[model samples]
Target: MAKTSSSHYALKFHRTSTWTMFLVYVILLVSLPDSSQEDCHCQNGCTDFPGSPCPGTTCQPDWFGSYCQKRNIARGKSTSQSSELQGYGGPFPSDKAVDGSTDQTLQHGSCTHTGDTTSTGAWWRVDINTTLEIRRMRIYLRRQNTDRNMGLQVNVSDQLCYTLSADNRQQTVLNIDCGEALNGSSVKISVNGPYLTLCEVQIFQCSNGWFGDDCDKQCQCQNTTEVCDKETGNCRGGCAAGKHGPGCQQECNDGWFGSYCNKQCQCLTASEACNKETGHCSSGCAAGKQGPGCRQDCGQHHYGVNCSSTCGQCSGTSDCEKDDGTCTQGCQQGYSPPLCKMCAVHFYGPPCQGCGHCKDDSPCSVLNGTCLTGCKPGYEPPLCITACIPGRYGENCLHTCGHCQINGSCNAQTGRCERNCQPGYMGPLCIQECADYTYGINCSSVCSCLNQSEVCDKITGDCRTGHQSTTTAAAGASAAHQGQGYDDIRLIVVSCLLAISCVYAVITTATIYRIRRSMKILKAEQMQQYSTLQVRGESSVYDVIAERSVYANESIQRHGDQDPNKN
Candidate 1:
């Protein structure tokens, strides 16, 4: 009545066979690395990332982490069961990427990689194993630890999706349009650093900027232009030129403000009295106040106005009476006269005996605002109207222009001018014309001119031929042609590498799958045989091998046609 070892083994095999096979199936579904990961280059035109894969071309070595840059998912439950089957390592947040799998028709088992897989900086990325037309994408994060966090960032490309960040542990949700990658065959997602575990990822058919069932557009202020939350209409903190503040609100800088930061304020200095509101200073202050706001009076013998004109020393008293600026008793009745006015020559003055015949040769003829002596050479004219022309400069055409005429600046000591024409301006004073084929900021580059090549000015950085040349007007084609040349070379190299990678990926995956399948079948039969033998029944190793042969053949056939990742 007691079971033998062989029988016990057989019993275990039969009881656990279903679960075992299912476990193996699950492993195959999730654990196996996707073949698409190997040839992740995009099939669609590169629109988002700077150097993502292009249609009909393998990606160049350079990469951008996200498949479609920063995308938001518009819909789908974050906890759908089918999502678990999406091929990737995470049911939990992963270090390298976030990805999923489905039974959509596959070409090369394509997937996406997000964020950087290389840098020490935070990064995240993802890869899609099958082609699915996505509606939208969502990337969400909750209460972040800013100090510990570098920041939250994501990039998605067609080939490899990578994600990384110093403080990405709070990130939780990311949704993307399934259709976006459907035609291309892959979706890549990346993060700057680490992102918190995902809740779910759903694919739907939605408009480019639309999100949710309502198809509401995303932050709409501008394309990639950081705007304030769409609902609030606030712009992002960093703004473009001439714009400032959250969503570019509250412009204020360069001494300007109000609506557009265009208002200017006057310059103020400690020595001048300034208008409080406008910051301008028009005149001196009143008595009792001195600095900046001047309300103080004059000193000692001086009183009103500016403390400049002085009152005479009267014979009656030592000080002037109350601000009358003169002795209340009147210069001791010294005959007659105002406080400080000097006496005329014929009539005795109160302060100086007289004006002393007022000499015309004294040079102070202008009085308060005059020069004490005759003017110098260049300074002879009343207003000094003329500036030295061309070759002449200084007090009276006194100095030579420094250096040669080719350069333009005078000598520091003599006021002489000099010149250096650089390349394009090859003539005298750096004014001669440049070569027929060169132009740029420094004249260091040649015009990549062909048919009607762009003729840039050799001396002044002006386009010598653009106004007359037809080639200058066809910039678009020229640019495209250039890109084509570079792209063609890049494509050739990439294609070769991709082909090799794809082939290697396929072979490796098939080998692993076959080996794993074979092992499972053999193990199961061994268990079965052991159980039978223990029960006093018999079955050989050959029986176990035979049972798996058919399954093996079928697996091999399937791999030949279907994608190896799905296997």
Candidate 2:
């Protein structure tokens, strides 16, 4: 019974506690601010607020501040005021305007208030620290005394951006479009009234290549490198290649091409257009022109289509015709007219120059102008155009000339002396020395030396003997006569001596003949006496007489006598 009673009391207590908690939750829900209303006031979504249970809100894109009313660009930037408000609720500075706050209450210290109430031009400024292309501005005016913001002028870098009239005096927020040209690093707000007060200043800049309200438009720039006008979207630099017009969306017209369509085509037909991108002609080039663009003229010595034809041999330093190969200035000296391709009668080579002097006045080789039959007298061989040099002559200029008078040259054909020969020299060439016993020019002078073997000087006719002959012509003749006389005398003497020798020989022969005859006679007589004695028988007497006769014969023979009486 006690446990059941305790359980029933605990159940009633639990019921009473649950009803009280439910009443407390309902009261809290009714007392709190509407979350949906708060969310509606916020631009983006809400976040937790500092020191409050309620959530805070964030700004939309390009917006800032607690209420999302200030531009993100001008928030927290450097600020200044022409003068600061002094005394009670005074000291309102310019920095309060760009503090990313939209609070309009002057006592909240979120607005700028100039102290000079008597002066008309009270101003506040902010330096964004960077040049920006601002298209619009949102000015938050002080709710109380809104007349102070009337006749206010907004300037960007000293250029007038907008002006607020008296009709805008009661407005808490003024939306002003400054247009695309209003770009600057600093923004200023000035009132023509006595004082100036601004709760906030918002600056809105469009994104790159976008402009106009909400920055929903894109730019139409011709050059990709250049930026277009923020509002008008016009290319400020120029149109791109093959494009024309302000927006750079049109194609090039006929006969025009390249950048801005400024270049004209150079095609073979005057009405034809060229390539828009490269300025090349589709058709062939005009006459005397070459290359893709047809702007280049033909090269030197070349003409006609594609410069295929070669020029002819023009006269002097002139060039040939560009349309044809004709020599407009005339052909060279010995070449034919018009094309100048053929050479004249006795001419040769490319220039058709005249030939050299050949033998017997004959023509030379047509190709090289060489003397085919050999060169004429006094000239060199081969070309045979030049005469022989000094001291040289003959067919090929091979033979050297002889020594001539006064060192003069000899005849080129015969090698003969031009003048008389030198002294001691004779002959046509003046190369022979004077003959024996002769000297001087032409060997006309005679030698006067005593000895015939002696020679004389050929140049001076001087004798070479030990002693010189001083005898004149007449003296020489006389000496010659005397020599002849002495030779005659010698010849006579020799003749006489020969005659005496012959006589002596004749006398000797006679004496010898007589002695022999006497001896023969004596012998004959001796034999006769012996015979007579022998016949008389007187031998002894005959012997004595014979002996006496022999002695007598010997003595007669020795005496050269033939007397038989002595015996």
Clashes of each: 120, 2
Question: How many steric clashes does model 2 contain?
Answer: 2
Clashes of 1: 120
Per-residue lDDT of model 2, residues 1-567, tens digit only: 999999999999999999999999999999998653442224544453212222254556555444443335787789998888886576688988888788999888888888876776888999989887666789888898877676889999889998887787788898888755676899999988668888888886544554445543444455666766655556777666666665555678977766677766667777787776556776765555676466666777776666677766778877776656578888878877676776766677766788776778787777898988887777788888887776677776777766566665777766677777777878886778889767777777766766655787878877656434466544764666689799999999999999998998889779878977886787787777777764544577677767777797687667665553576
- TM-score against native, each model: 0.17, 0.32
RMSD of each: 68.5, 38.0
> What is the lDDT for 544 in model 2?
72
Candidate 1 lDDT (Cα, 0 to 1):
0.41
Best by TM-score: 2
Error of 2 at 367 (Å): 20
For candidate 1, lDDT tens digit of each residue in 150-263? 343333334322233444444444433332233433333322343322322333332332223322223333334453342233444333333444444333554432223333
